[model samples]
Target: MRTSLACGALMGMWLGTALAEDDVESVRARSNPAQGYCERVRGTSRAEAALEWAPEVFASVGAVNAGVAIGGNDDTPLGSPKMRVTAGLGYDFVGIYRGRTLRSRAEAECRRYQALAALQGALARGSRLGETEALQARARALAEALPQAETLVSSLREELRDGSATLEELNAVQVRLDQLRSLARDTEQARARLGLEPAVAEGQDLGALLTAFESADDQVEALAGGLRRARAWRVSLRGGYDEVFDEILDVDQDTPLFGQLTVGYNIGHLWQGKANAQAREGRRQETRDAVDSAPRQVRQLLGELRLTEQGEQQRLREVSTLVSDLEGQLREVEQLETRQVRRFRDYLLLELARLKAEQAYLGAHLKTLQSLLGGVKS
Candidate 1:
């Protein structure tokens, strides 16, 4: 079992916002690992990490209302009292509706954030499936070709390190590595355009990753050389040499070349064999640990999402049922407007209310299915 939702590493500021807002949407947004949630991606995320920041829709409403109450005036006579009350409340003024838009703004941010995450997860799952097919294809092409390619790449790298690999081979591998890097970068940009953050690569380009892999492979190879008088000893010498040149010009070109020597020894007998065996087993162990973790974490996220889905589904059902109830209530409001023309604006506002209820109901229920599958098309 993994840890609880409270301690996953992205909840501090979100929690603060939660306490500050303390509303329904706030509760929904702050439920799980919304940060580092991009770890679900194959790479690091390239999106704005602000849903975890001081995310609220309106900052001035409270202050404005506080001021209006303090001053005892309908300062917002031109607009809604709610607007006049929060206008000068001391916050970053964005536009005309800044004071009145906090709640709506916060909800929008939350929706955008969840949408970004879902897109990333969907893209990654698709990419992973593609990689699976590619791996299978590679396997078929390797009829004993696996070990052969490994040896070819290894010997080629060894030659390169020893200043013996031909330019052609080095250039070819370098090109391949560059191409992979370009592909990764392009994938990240595509995600970003979709409002998802770019996932960062843990290591460098393909060249760097391959080089590191080769270095490790070399170590593993040397280790597996087994119990024997391995000639893997490295020797360095330090000395001075003198040479004379033109005596006619009296140019004594006698410069000494001095350096140092270093030697290393390993009882290749047990050490090599043990290291080789352990390296293979250790790699498999690490992979097993990772594989075990992936779907578990994915499912956990999915479960949290499912609960939200159920709750939203319930909420939508209630809203729709209320919609039916509101149909009669709406006619009453209209009838009152006919008797009292002054009630026209309020009657229309009620109509908007009913519309919003229906719209929200549909969105909530639709999200249930969307969040469960972890796919939302923008």
Candidate 2:
């Protein structure tokens, strides 16, 4: 449910825009967890006002040699030296018959705004995602280190019980393990605040993200259509009814209704249409290029992401092998007649090194994931 980013820890950290707190059930929630983009994209709309006509007035007078009034019978006044007067008042105005074209222009503007919002919102979310994932990686690293620290503390405690290790050394080891645990807990809580505690579902990865790129290509076609419609000129038509008030006719016969029709072309509007068509072509091409390049760029990013993950896997394997070797050396030292605490210290350091390596690799992998879906081209 895309609403506001006010609740997330990442809010106000990436971009100035924030999301609302409303949550809804939809596919949109998968891509926009904070709902910031969805709320902003909804601003595109159209507005309309009531129609009004320009006013026109007409007056005419003539010596009547028995002119028949409207709705007059044959017995009506005829052959009389009478002065006839008729005054017609009407409302008229030149209208460009391009209402559809005007609407198209409005819609085009709306889509452009939506595209801009999409781009900016994606960038903001991507930056936030990167930051949150980094926190999570740190938390995981501390978690791994905590257990190693605890194991070392337990071994020292046993030596203290055997009178081989001093209480001060055991207490120091316990304190280090407790510090690691406290740091890990704080990191996890920070990650949770950022909404990164429960990772995204597996299904919403590269496959779903690529589908979004295809959808963008479809929007280009719609934008082209909107631009074409926006460039068209509207034809003007003026038609209305006018009631005539005849002072002479009222004395002779009852006044009647008269209808007026006007037809005209707007050359200036047509010329403007030509200019608009040319201007709109440039926008059409720009939008098309933006949309067309999105999919290819996403595909390339996906490849980069895969490579990053593969590299991380290899590093994890090498680090794990080194940790295993160090453990085996510690065991060999334990079986030796000579007691050397150096071997145990080396094993602890090796474990810590392995944990740090895991942390680094996982952080890199998280950044790659963020790039894949965060709408960042690079």
Candidate 3:
């Protein structure tokens, strides 16, 4: 029988998780109209466009040279009165390096925007509408019980004046009633900001919710891309065809086309590149370390949240048991006025306790959900 009960409980939990998944999907579908608004507001669309066109933009950064030179002896020179026209093209490697860096930075921004969008979507779907409704109901119950509590306090004060009740008893009842009044007001205000929107059902599987938040290594990618660009800036290549036309030379003697290739390294930029590469490599290593440690950090956070949830659940159970006991006691002494008064007071206080316990448990549950869904922020 114990094994059967355990299996039944597990099956119920599984069903609850399945239902929660469906609820999440429903909420996501409902919120789809507002999706990507965050990215658009943040101007990531332009950054995305920049990333797409980065290669062509950088490839176009080059120099084209065209010149006319005339130099020859006017008298009996081999190519007197010679006029030469030259055209060539050259590129600077620094421009390519800068373009690559800009592209990497744009990619990093895009990744950050994606991460924020995911977080916002999770929050939108995980609305606290149900929790707010529950609080509103609690507020209504508190409101209805306030008059009864005031009547009880008045009777207690009269009893204290006639020496039928102690001052301590009167004060305790007054304090409890005051607490209930305050709690009622606070609960009423809790519903003030709630919107009428469907939300994912409570008791979602943490692992499943966590699947929505994947760790992003945008910083590492940017740094590594920078390092690559820095290392690549050491070498420069200039290859082009120069065309020259000489008026003084015959067609066979004229060098109409000359092909030249120049491969060179900037020793100055080599030193600069070494320094830049070292700095970028160091930064990349630091980012890599952080990314590697993120999983452990997330695990620690989730573990703490789970423990808090368990604690709140335990408290809710204890408060529920107390409320149940008080109800039974109140019913047992229905005909005894004095006993009923005392039992009723205890019941009212225990009812408040139960509500608070429920609130705390729900709060813990929400915290756990947010932590699991947000993961490590980018």
TM-score winner: 2
Question: Between prediction 2 and prediction 3, which has the larger lDDT?
Answer: 3
lDDT values of the candidates?
Answer: 0.38, 0.48, 0.50
lDDT of 3 by residue, 89-192 (tens): 44445555555555555555455444444434334543341354355446545545565566667776677789878777766666776676567546544543
Give all TM-scores, in the order shown. Answer: 0.25, 0.46, 0.44
Q: Give the per-residue lDDT digits (tens) of candidate 1, residues 1-378.
A: 112221222234235433543453354355444454423321221122222222233222221211113244765432212222121111121221322233333333344344434434433543221122222222232222222333334555667788755656555544543333343334333322322223322111222322333344334333333212233443434334322233333433354333345565655544555666666677544532455543334444445545565665677677667766666666666565342332332333333343443444346335434523443111
Better of 1 and 3 by lDDT: 3
Steric clash pairs (candidate 2): 2-35, 3-20, 3-35, 4-19, 4-20, 5-19, 97-235, 98-234
Please give, for residues 19-88, the per-residue lDDT of candidate 2 as tens digits.
3112212334565533444344333222221122234456766665654544568676554555656566
Q: Which predicted model would earn the best lDDT?
A: 3
TM-score computed on alpha carbons, candidate 1: 0.25
Error of 3 at 103 (Å): 4.9
For model 3, the stretches where C-alpha displacement exceeds 4 angstroms are: 1-105, 112-170, 181-215, 218-247, 250-300, 333-378
**Of 1 and 2, the candidate ranking higher by TM-score:** 2
Best-to-worst TM-score order: 2, 3, 1
